[model samples]
Target: MSEAVDPGVAATSEPKEEKPCVQCLVPEIMTAWNSARGACEFVPDEKGREECRKELEEIAKDVKSIKKGSEVIYKAIKSSSNPAAFIQAQIEFAKTHNAANTEAILKWADEMEKAGKEIPEDIAKIVKFYRIQAGSQI
Candidate 1:
């Protein structure tokens, strides 16, 4: 007779579907930053710590890219044939980015202005509001 095995422990059982363990990317990224900071401050090996610092810098660059992408997408909505989805995505991105992302978005607007490109009124006004909110930081 074949040995009985529990169904829960069966290797042949279909794989359980994975669900979101992290609610959003923002919190997950923050966790990554905290982990990187810990590694930078507490890791004993110099090479490993340096690697962590590089990894942290790469994460920062990715965040900058995401900010720029959201800014461009939000501004580009004016020209889109179907803008509803893009607008919603932009709103979601803004919710995650908060005030800290304003400087970069404003800087992008400045370059567009300098290049003789018209800043879309909606984007222009948002950047202007942020610039005011940022005050001396801008």
Candidate 2:
């Protein structure tokens, strides 16, 4: 006969690590870029600074994708005064990026709620519209 396993000594599986938020990565990238800005002697020149600034702006735009995601999340939480054009932009992005889905959108909304932010009504309407349109089997 096999002996019973001890409950306290049973091996437990490790929890899956959470993915880093895109927004979270942006600040880190920004910090590194800014540090590069400070350390470069050539950056003292206007042209050099401008070039770095342009690159930084591009990175910021990428970071704005995270902002868009956050906006969608906000839309999910509560109604808003203004349409979340930015968030709508994100839904479009999700479609473009092949990331569109109710689960993903709802997850984004959940994230916003967890962060203590509410989705504005206007933005939610926009997101809802796009989602419905996307589902049509035309």
Candidate 3:
């Protein structure tokens, strides 16, 4: 005498795929990081502050990863007139985002893209992943 009225909500409730658009989700993640930063302001005592900072750093790392994913997209969409300036800005932005080595590595990628070549498999692989931190949960 089993009731045959069960719905498929269990299957529908499962999460979707993880790899979102490389460009679209960066700012969204940044906004979440910002909210965490805001909460960090109220963390009292040195130990609590340190713990909050650690979580913030994890969120920052994810932000850095998002920026890397972004560069994989942005090189095509760069707006500056000079490639030199464009690359320079990208490098600076990467540094600001805590990725000091990213610019030098990306320069090679930029050259590859400039030559109308497809992104190398290894580099393209970078664009295939994203795991954003759960910011502001503290």
Candidate 4:
């Protein structure tokens, strides 16, 4: 004789079709990135740092494949404690996509200044370049 299975258990056995939501994913990815960054800081050894960096790289890979992935990467750049990584991601993105939002770059520069975060000279140059590019669009 077969034992009765609970409806909830039967439901769990079947895979449900679900579409991914960008809004839901972006926050989760950012949170994971932030947590990994925080974990990196507490790591005193180089090996520990390397591990943390690997985890961050994995998350970065995930960012590139999602819908509205550009938005996620851009926000990550803005909020990153180590913006260099995200900047590299953005550069790679631009290389393939041949697109970068000038308004967003300028706004990021402005926001960084307003927040008392010093804009690296290289980044300043990039912002300037984008500004000129934006003007040329007119």
**For this target, which candidate reaches the highest lDDT against the unseen true structure?**
4
lDDT of 3 by residue, 1-138 (tens): 854556855534578767767567767666555544444444444555455546556546545465443343243223223334334433544445544344445556567678998876876554232111212121
**TM-scores of all candidate predictions against the true structure:** 0.29, 0.26, 0.31, 0.32
| Candidates' C-alpha lDDT | 0.55, 0.49, 0.48, 0.62
Worst 10 residues of 4 by lDDT: 89-98
Clashes of 2: 7
Q: Which stretches of candidate 2 lie above 4 Å from their native place? A: 1-18, 22-27, 39-44, 64-138
User: Model 2, 1-138: lDDT tens per residue?
Assistant: 977778886555687777677767666555544443332223334654455445444544555444433332342222212224323433444444444465577567667768999789886665566556569321
| Separate clash counts for every candidate | 0, 7, 0, 0
**Per-residue lDDT tens digits of candidate 1, residues 11-96?**
56688785434445556556544433443433345664565456456555656343332333333344333355434544554554
lDDT of 3: 0.48
Model 3 RMSD in Å is 17.6
Candidate 4: give the clashing pairs. Answer: none
True-vs-predicted CA distance for residue 79, candidate 1, Å = 43
Evaluate model 2: give its TM-score.
Answer: 0.26
